[model samples]
Target: MLAADLEYFQDVQNAYAALTNLHCIITDKQGNPITQLNNDPNVFHLVYDQETFKEVLNQWTRDFSKINSAIVYDALPGVKVIICPISIQGEIEFFIFAGCLLESTSKNTVQTYFEKILQNPEKANAIFTLIQEYSPDEIQAKLRKINKMAEVLIEHLATQNMKAHLVEQEENLGELLHLIADGNIKVTAVLERFLHENTKLDFVGYARKKGHDQFVIDECILPEVSSTLKGTVFSMGEGTLGQAAATRIVRFWDHMDMDPRNLFFQQKGIYPKSLFCFPIILEKEVIGIFFGGSSQFVRLENDISRVGKLTSSLIKVIEGNRFWQKQSKNNLMKMTALNEIFQVMTDVEDVKRILLIMLDLSINLIRGPFVAVIAKQSSRNSYEMVSRGLTADQIENYSSDISNRYFHNKQNKRFYHQQPVEHITSWSSKVLEIPIAYRTECFGFLSIGLSEQMLKEDELSFLMSLTIAGGVSMHLLEATTKVKMGQTVIDLLIEHQEYIDPDHFKQATKARELIKGFSGFSTYGKINTIAVKYSCYFIKYDEQFLTNKIKNDLIIDIVREYKLVADSKLEFSQASLNVQVLSLVWTYINEDENIDFLLKINGMNLPLLNEFLAYLSHTTVVESEIMVTNKPTANEPKISKHLKLSKREIEVMELVLKGNNNREIAERLYISEHTVKNHMTNIFQKLAVNDRSQAIAKIYQMGLEPEDVS
Candidate 1:
């Protein structure tokens, strides 16, 4: 506790003086006279020996604050004053002085002695007038009364100081607790304050015991030393701190150089003489060690006990903070994964492609071997699926022959299923299957292999939610495909209504009405019938047709107009024509190809007759090999529009094509390694490719030119 402000306590000084009828002055424990309470000048100050009295007063002040009783001292040769020591809590905090009398054998002798000290004969008698002469008995009574009053004042001051000190300590402790609660104050900061306020030390450090026998100094705060000691690790019994850690006890010694194990403070110009080491115990185990050094020998038990209480609490606060930080990081990662999966599902247009992305995401998220999606075929009583590490044939056979034999009804057209129980089967891998259904309609099933660590309960629930969302999105995309197909049929029939036969025209008109009502395929059947009556066939691109097997009279595919260059040489008249034409595909073969061409029964625009044969003309034809290539043409720029890449993905892809690795790309882009990796994955997924090599090849095929990363 800090010393009280004695300069403002003049009332105590005046009270002592008024009761004793003597001038008084007060001073503190350090012997610095605070101030004179009474400043009246008299002949005693003028005639007394001033220089000799000032010297005596200086010596008296230094010797008096510790005294327990009142004592009389000669201020001058014959003049005297009484000094009383004032104490609080058994330690003298202040001293009170009172002027008493001047003594001599006779008035003339007193006058002559004062005249020699003052060097003025006129002031010699004036000094006797100011001095209060008292009998020995009277002086004794006054001294006793003054001593009693001074003691009472000291007791009062002691009580006040105790209250102030208690309040100060409480406030300091409250602030420390608040700092811990905020988590902004570190262990090093707390140690700095504790060492400064509670102990006199040149250096202090806190170290954590790690591994088998290593102690790492995590937070080191030193006032007199400027060298850094943090992150310094030492083996057990290697240094002062290490020894304390090994023994699990407080250690203290002087002559630091005598002990070669003290490595903390040693210099050519300055040597540490003393040091202390102690352990912070929690639950019968030492969690941390405290080490500090001073220039003088410290009280071992007093210093170690004081610091041990502080460090024990400090360790607990540190542990709690680290636990919360770890939990927060885990939660953030989980949320990011969930958000990324949901975004990929709702944003991608194709249902099959979305399933492929989800499979990749789930495999990484669960650290598993494979994930699969099995969708029921629309026109057959079977299932079609996409998977990783498992073939569609394997999935179809398993669900049909092995799984359905016991679990599903082969005759029933629709099946409702929750997740299937695990069992040994003909398949080589274990699998977990959950139904992918939304509301009342069951679309398909999701199959995940049980080859690695299964997800936690909450993670599994999130996975289930993702699957349900995927099913709903797929159902919507399926409905959209059907609507587009129905609209295409309606457009075809309406475009050729005039050329169509009268009966066919009425059928085509009715088909348009059915398509508008969204009665899918029932309307297409009617339109197909009408086209058959006109001797034209409506055919979707069949896989068998790729080998020149023609099962229909009209084949529909997305054939470019330029691919039909051979048709320009056909021989024809306005009425006479007999020819066969074939269209070469120059674009991607889409599964849902739109109708872009119409053919008549006689392969002519107008009716052909035998009478118009005279006008028939022979035409020359040139043939060339038909090839579909994503390779850029001579006139086409290397940067083509076919590769639909986002701006950020394109930036990353350009760097990838330049042969920059993930780390290099992250450095160039000023992003984290994890973010660069995520971008690379996104680029691969968007390009419909797997690794960096495949992604580069696919982009090159789309005429993407390489650019410098810089």
Candidate 2:
């Protein structure tokens, strides 16, 4: 909201003036009268019309806006002005001079204010009597009333703003369509007006990204700015502005005058107390950075949020520009790329070769930057993946077995998924997934990261056709190739057990095992998978590498000593491959004990096994959950809830039972030690105990159970 927005309502101004006997006028920041809202301006005319007395009038209003409150300003001896500052978005732009009257204390000597400025003192006796003596309390009451009226005014403006914004959005869509059709990328021109109309900042800058790290200022919106800001180049990650671009998150910095990180503004002789940086994002990539700041501290509403919405809408309107058919450039290539995928699929019998080519074709057809083939864990207990345009780090992030969790119970057709930021370093915003399935059995997933949204009807049809053909071909080809893969330990169980699919991992209720320090568990009919990675073959790094018969015994002892019933394992002995990957899925016939958490707790528990995990590298202990029946099993401990505790506190108590110190538990949970201590403190208060030992005793007495968490 701006001072100009306040001027739209004239009756509100008159009503305020009528409530108190005072001339109501809008004045410049320095207090010079600009527009009169009420008829009580004869006093104003006498002051402004008088050449010598106008200086005194200016002195009355000078710095009134800076006061930040309603005040009875003493303009001259025996005279005062009732003024209230109208602040919009924390910037004082103008003042409302509601009253010009004689002061109560100077009733008899009112002629003092007019001694130098009054040209005809005897003739203006009636004008002096027209001015009435006003109490400060009355003016204060009137000011409070104006505030109440503003509350109502704000509600009215909200409804009107929504209607206006809709119209503006429609118009902006039109502007964006023309730009897209013309192939022009001057997006700043479309965004500039909204900033000017809705905000009042001391300095506003727009920097366009020229390279990966380089950004050059294309424009700066401010009046009479003397310092050089435009054409200034800033690297990504240089300051708060760079951080916003790097993280794609909006950030605000305050007290920048005292911070050396404000060099961008400091160099321009503009030290802002509060500053905001917004990364202008398109297809999850920051093309520019928008900067806004005030030399003084100010409050912010959804000004940035509204602009963010508009910017998103801009991307959509251009990317999905309904007039796309008018340009034959994109439509011309749709069929050619569609034809190439079918030609490659019919002749390819190798599954991975076909998958790799399909991924490449997806990138070529859609102009997307990334594509991946995410396969479900095979019998060897490992997921085989092939990707294009994705880094090794990115590929690792996607191997989170999202499909295993996402498709547990429900079956989905071709779908679009926006990749969430797993951490600060990775940005994978949108992906289109086409499940590679043979009938109901989903063998793998085909995904394409969308650099442009809204696939054309024909383009989507072509992708669907390719995936359907590829799935059928891959499923038939895997029949013969699957014979030589590594086997699952489920076959080695003492009792013959039923076969289970690798993807069906339970997610809820089974987390009950966390209480007893088991990493993750399942009930009667459910199963859980625990994945582990190794650097190389056992022969290459281990002095204890054994023959085929001894190797099985060594691995079984190493695993059983840690209380795990290994359900599946994969070991690659080829000299050509540098790394050997292993995924462990723990399973049992009658639900025998498999304590997964012990491996992490025992820092030096298994020297040979720890060597297998790697002597130095960080071993991540991530847990995946599965849902079992709420009914407790025969061997499961039945504990009752007797005291109030938080979910985290109960989990902390579980780790305490495992004999883990505070530091170990902190590392295990990926939380700070301070947070673990806080949970411990809460646990102490709930159990009425002061130490870990006493709390553990009380927990046992209370019969702590998984369901007891409340």
Candidate 3:
């Protein structure tokens, strides 16, 4: 039995992959994986995983030979498995096979097979969702092409075997293999020298350019011939080189008249009696073509054994070069894209405009045709308000479906899921949702379509790293902008502090009431803290307790004035002047103590904001919280038995005690307003109270305690 090492088979497998979509596997005579079976994503995984399929595949591998060519076996429903035999020293040594090739036109049958295997309808549906369907004729044509290529591959392998024995005896031939295998010389250079020395003929090489689909003359001897053929493009099946490439077989023309499209002879006018052509194949597909011609009789068939071995070695080097070149290109593109993103975020001040740029550049960065940025609203579900390459109808469709919201998770999360659209002809149905976030705060999602030609795992990993960095950069920009605005507010407060007179109680009261108009920060506790802390600079500690009374009376007076302004239909900005005045008064009222609170509230860097705050304010000793009692409470006997509220009613009443409105209470408890109102009515009847104020008063009066009320 002839045995090949795992590395050798792996090289062959990689080379064959460049030529076709069908998964190929090379195995030893015993049917073990050559270099370990590819884990489940490959066809071999399926063949090896299922016992029924494995038995059929193993039997076919054993029976395959040069005599029988190959044996067809069952793999998946409607999919055919074909194994071609490789012979070495007059015995079958290896078996190469292609699987998951559809033999029937029915896609349903294929879907059913996967459904049975996986037992998941959704997964089965998704497997078929992204598949580009092929007709029966197309499938048959593909199979025929693959089968012919397999036959040529088998012949090439046999030729290598024959040449191996010859190489052991011939030192020059062994050196040629060593040189080409070691990548010391280009495969074309060695092939050209070998052909001229051994057969007295020049070699011509044709390979596809990196980005272009058409084949071009790559390497050749004969300066005149090379000059004439340079820059010439050949489409598949157009000329002799193309024919050799398309067929993946040796093409021979013993007479000049036999091949009319042979460019060397046609363009350079160098007529030869015989010409030999062969394809440079990798992974089962043609990557380049080779041609050699002689002015006299040249035994091409006798030399095929040596030529095939050299060609295989050349393929390895070419593949390696292509892989590195593609990686380099992708890295450069990624860096350029990331640099552009950084520039836009750094320079752009408008958050909306910055977001738009981010959404636009993300499409090109990921190479996806469709892209979108979906942000979650505070009150409702996440929505797709902005998108690129999507129609109005598609946007509307996405907005209505809650499932389309991929950025709903409060923590940073990512999803790469395939979404099936009604229109299959759209750019792509596959989608990836990457969370745009900083730390634990997710701002939005970057959604993009997935292309069929996806980035390799390493490239994808690099892209994800950049994406996370980009998200953090965006978050920092937003925070920085807020800090800048807060600084502006601080400047306004310092510049206008003298405009308000402390002795002018009307102006002071008006300012206080306007500040109270801002419901978000007008709580009794917050107002008292602002007053006590700030007024300490202007008032003594003994009189500091009177500052709270002054702040409270001013707020009450301002509220009465605001109601009069509302009755007279006053301009909002005029009413807003009161707030502006209050900001100045409060700045002075809190004295230097407002610095820390302002810095914390605006999310500014503590050290930096402290420096600015210190430079703007007159330094004063900041006091600790002074305990102050609210409305007097009278001790009462416990009356817990008199109030029998259901758990839900007590929950609502506790929210009422915290001064939450009906909507806020409902939202906090995750209930409806109508339900909250019903709870309130029940609590009112249980406590024999008229409104919220009396209900709370009775709860305190009865001294009824509730568990976990807070």
Cα lDDT of model 2 by residue, 1-710, tens digit: 44534553454566666767666776556656555547743666665555654465466556453666666666555666666665554566556665567645666567644644576676356456667765667656766765544443444445446646655654554444345435464445654654555454676666778877888887786554677578888888887777888888777776677887888778877777887876765434577787777777664333455554445334333332322334477754543443444445545766678778777767777776677876654433346789888888788877664554444435433222222222121463677676665444666777767765666655664565456546545654554332222222211111111111112212111221221122222121112222111110121122242222123443333333223212213222221111111211122111332222223232222222222222111112221113333544555333223465655666776677656799999998899999999999888887777776566545434434323332
TM-score of each: 0.36, 0.33, 0.25
Give the distance in Å from residue 93's predicted Cα in candidate 1 to where it truly belongs.
9.1
RMSD of each: 40.1, 25.9, 31.0
Q: Rank the candidates by TM-score, best first.
A: 1, 2, 3
Prediction 3 global C-alpha lDDT: 0.51
Per-residue lDDT value at 650 in model 1: 70
Count clashing residue pairs in model 2: 8
Better of 1 and 3 by TM-score: 1
Q: Would you give me the overall lDDT of model 1?
A: 0.54
lDDT for position 153 in model 3: 47
lDDT (Cα atoms) of all candidates against the true structure: 0.54, 0.52, 0.51
TM-score for candidate 2, please give it.
Answer: 0.33
